[model samples]
Target: MQRRKYLKGMATAAGIVTVSSTGNAQVWDSDELSKGEEPKNPSPPRKGDSVMGLTDQIDTVNVGIIGLGNRGFSMTQLIDAMAPDKGVIKAICDIREKPVEEMSDWIKEEGKNDPPATYSGSKNSWRKLVQRDDLDLVFVFTPHQAHTPMAEYAMKKGKHVAVEVPAATTIQECWTLVDTAEKTQKQCVMLENVCYFDIEMWVLNMVRQGVFGDKLTYASGGYIHNLVAEYFFEAYWKDWRSKNHRKYKGDLYPTHGLGPIAFYMGINRGDRLEYIASQESPETQLTERAKELPEDHWAHGADDWANGDTTRSEILTEQDRQIHLQFDVKTNRGYSRKNELAGVDAYHEGFPSQLAVDSEGHGFVDDATYDQYYEEYRHPLWVQMEEIAEEYGGHGGGDFLEIYRLFDAFNDGRPPDMDVYDAAAWSAVRPLSATSIEYGGIPVKFPDFTRGDWQNKRKLQVMDFDTI
Candidate 1:
């Protein structure tokens, strides 16, 4: 893992090379590219060469979903709920036959006129689903490692992609996805459901309306949970998550916490992530907990878990906005994303969700004021879809809202709420954090996946509630 020098004009380069495994790049600056210096690595698209406003008007989004695992299977309900009107599931795929067959049967039981075509039995089976011309949109809910390649493949095959969170595991993979999406001129959206959470949306609306004051000083977020009992044992299909914990040292699952904060701070739009430094607590609990598992369990005798009990990362935005993120799954703690925000005039925090405004000296506002703010600033999307979201019920209805927005964007022939740059920038935190930790918590430069275009401010589609 050789670290290349951070190029001075990477953001301005006409063609940029793929990042190395160590999160550094061997770039071809605009001068070199203009002088006919061929880049050894594949080059990413130039600044402002983006799929930001890419559009293809489809009357009905013919959907294909790969990976019929737990998360994938659950998403079928959301897709089903939107079928015939917004989109229809045209194909389904998995490496295992059981889940694929089960999904097919479920589609049949749901009385779809055309039960989705199923593909399975081989690792490459998903390519069949992606290659289907009938599919206008593809939802990739595969494991973390496969997300980037799957998304790149789907986009190159002429289908819009909506992939599950943390779309790429490495900086190189992030560049690959961004380049593929740009080359294909197709939408590559990361399905970060947390951005659609009720509190998050409401706070976003408030921030836009100046409720959080003019300058947002700092924010805090985390993906803190205790997963040893379930996810480490039987939850993940092949112990993928546990295995990742055994191999990786950074914030493996960062999007759940980072996505909402990015939206609040306008990452990859009006602001860019400049750099991050990360440190982790020593590994202790997971090793001790591994002994409790049966001998046949994957973690039964595992003592060399690369992940520590906790990891903390501090990020600086180009606008000088500070963000603090925490990741921990080895602890026996209650679930929380820690969503916290602060401004000169107001402050808020999620998980018991308190709000205070008017002055920093003032403590949290009374319940009455908080409830009033909710009534006054409730996001229009939530206002319109709250009933259905609550009924569908996934992650306090954020999951349904996320799916709704995806299909809604497809139906209207508009850019999704999150595009490739957003996906790449958010997911890059995983690798960037890991690299920082690897170097004893030195600050690692964060890639501007949007290139220099992050300087241009733009409105988020999610804020435009009147459209969908």
Candidate 2:
């Protein structure tokens, strides 16, 4: 009560400045201040048993794809690279007809016996694709808001779902995914390709081998990229990316930075995110750029930019480990996932890639030593799939590696490397941090989607590469 009062007083003193659609500043209702209060974490009415090691082996994964944009189209090509042995694209969908038809032709050209069935020209056309009894797996590469609904519907239809990053936008959607996946006994995997990057995998191998030493306590990572042109222009189908900036505050996109760190730290495996607090820089860069658009541009009328130029969130784990995450896309900077991990004996930071051991001085090792570490500790999966992944080509081959692992697990009738709990836990950062920032950086509790099952120690399925 007192904190809310203080925040209200501050808002009143500062006049609660809110931007109108025409880029004019105006006073907003103080009632909006109450939005930051911690929401009730209610258990779902329908309970489902834990799917910790669930498996449904498939002879071959018959795949259906929704959303044929840049990411979706690229994924089709990657799936084609796997072909009839591992999987096949049975059907494809999009809101527009051209891409669907074009992709079908491309797949036909790739020497498949039959072209994939196409669904398009309707917003809800994806439903028909998911309802198909032939599909064993459905890939959702749609817009952010559609991820949860499509994934849930697919799971309920008895098909496993693989969705793009930040699998959900809200906490409710996160729970919906968890519950649906559990009840239906279908996999709900978030396609976080960064988790499969060669450098990230090497680090995972080192951590598993105890090279980072015991009681690893702290780590930090972030997504820093210059997407101004893509976000502001017509790069998106309907400028949905920028609309999110105008509709929400705090870390809008978080999984790219958080996913690999979660794996390194064993999130939802041994430890889980307990709570998060965040602070965001004032909204300046995006709003200023929005004003520069011509009057006829869609963004010309968009004045209320809710997200900030940068957002920093801190998380505490159940084991008292600390994690830091950052989200930024407006700034002009080289792309980085800022992957960093620190333990008692050593430290590692990516994006220029550095590694340090506990020597007398304790600094980054020499170039030769770094090269040796890469040679010695390179993850087995990377060693096995590097050539093929490179040939397939997506995000330095991480994308192809991720798909290969997913299908490998399916073929072997083993649980996936990532599961529904992981999808929920990692994507929960977006809403949790937004609430923290809204309530003046108050710490917000994270719902343990695992329902106390995370304490059972288990190996990450991806690390079990001996089968390869």
Off by over 4 Å in 2: 1-42
Error of 1 at 361 (Å): 1.2
Best by the lDDT measure? 2
Question: Candidate 1: what lDDT?
Answer: 0.83
**Ten contiguous residues minimizing lDDT sum, candidate 1:** 1-10
lDDT of 2 by residue, 230-323 (tens): 7766775274787788888878889988898899889998898876778999877767776888898877756688898899998878787889
What C-alpha lDDT do the candidate models reach, one value each? 0.83, 0.84
TM-score of each: 0.90, 0.90
lDDT of 1 by residue, 25-51 (tens): 543455765554434422355533578
